[model samples]
Target chain A: MLTYANPNRFMQLARRLTRPVWGLSLACLIIGLYMAFSAPADYQQGMTVRIMFIHVPAAWMSLFVYTFLTVSSIFGLVFRHPLGHVAAKSAALIGAGFTLITLITGALWGKPMWGTWWVWDARLTSVLVLFFIYLGYLFIWKAIEDPLQAGRVSSVLAIVGFVNVPIVKFSVDWWNTLHQPASVSRFDAPALHSDYLWPLLVMALGFQLLFFALWLLRMQTEIFKQKLRVRRLGLVETSNGTAS
Target chain B: MEHVFYIGLSYGVTGVILCLLTANTLSAFFSFRKQIDDEFKPEDSANSP
Candidate 1:
């Protein structure tokens, strides 16, 4: 793992993995969609329950990506690893996109089931706060001029903002929310039926694979951006030397 | 069913959003790669036959 701390080695690994990971993600999504559509509808929610196939997975990915971001930020701050900041920066947009999908799809599911588009419930509100934290992290990166300073500031935000993640997860249990408590992730056996459970798991796997594929691509782009910045600086220094 | 519209809209919106995100990430990746390649290519060409 430490061997990949070197950008050149990491780039080599990323180039090799990006295509295969993408292919696997597409394959999983196709299979997962087929399974999701074929699964029997719930007696309660009817066809509207199909929304869970997309909604739950996006929710899971949104949380998962933020956790990933926070961990990377920790590595960057504590270890001073070169690629740590790059990894955290690369993951922000992808995490935010997943969070957006979670919110929109949650609303679509809520309208039919809860008879409302949204509520100020604990789970929903905390997730919304999480999304804002993601946006703020991204904004800090853009607002700061120096890379090192931006990395340090945004990393602090990522670490602090991570407190919301567990709060979002346990919110339903902690409060009497309209949202149900954990169905598939409880310590006990899952509340979801095998029919819904299987397809949901497949979709979650697909979402995870897609996140990895995108993360590598974004990290590679960040590395190239860093390289270009250094090259431009060198060029300016060389011209100034000649002028002097 | 009556709720078919809700389900359809959810999946439809998700597909579109994911597609757009994927497109944006790919474009950014290729754009940066191209810039870096161009930045180095001149020095390579200048040194070669």
Candidate 2:
């Protein structure tokens, strides 16, 4: 991993990876959607259960991407790897996108199942806070002119905000929220039957792959921007040297 | 059948968001790559034998 920390090498690997990752993601999404549509409707929820195919995966990705951001921020702060900052910075918007999808889909799912579009419950509120934290992290980067200072500040913010992740995860369990507790993840067998379980797992895998594809592309863009800035600075220095 | 609208809307919204994010990232990637290439064009041509 450290050896591939160099931006050029990372870009090479990313270029090689983007195509296969995207292909697999597309395949999974198509098959998952087909299975989701074909599966028998839940005896209780009926057709609305199809919403779970998207909602659960988006919710999973919201937490997963934040964890990615937190780990990348830690690498940036502790290891002082330049790529870590780039990775952390690039991941913010993608994470926010997933978070937004989670919130919106959850609301859509809730309206049909729980008879409400929105609720101020523990699980819902914590995820909302996570969304705001993402926005704040992005704003810090844009507001600070110096990349180093921006990176330092946002790294601290990400690390500190990571406490909310577990709270978001266990909120349903700890509190008497309207939200349901863990189904797919449990010590015992999953609560969901195989019909729904398979499609949900496939969709989750597709969403995760899609996140990686976007993250890689964004990181490449950031590296290019940094290179351009360095080149422009070099040109300015050269012109100044000639003038003097 | 009555709940079909809600289910469709959920999938539609998620699909739209994912598509937009993917498009935006790819667009940015290409734009930045072009800028970098244009910026270095002079040096590249100058180094040619």
Best by lDDT: 1
lDDT (10s digit) by residue, model 2, range A66-88:
99999999999999987888899
The TM-score obtained for chain B of candidate 1 when compared with the true chain B:
0.78
Per-candidate TM-scores read 0.96, 0.96
CAPRI band for model 2 = high
Clashing pairs in 2: none
Alpha carbon lDDT at A26, candidate 1: 94
Provide the interface RMSD of candidate 2 in angstroms, 1 decimal place: 0.7
How do the residues A121-210 of candidate 1 rate in per-residue lDDT, one tens digit apiece? 999999999999999999999999999899999999999999999999999989998998888988889999999999999999999999
DockQ of each two-chain model: 0.89, 0.90
| 10 residues in a row with least lDDT, candidate 1 chain A | A1-10
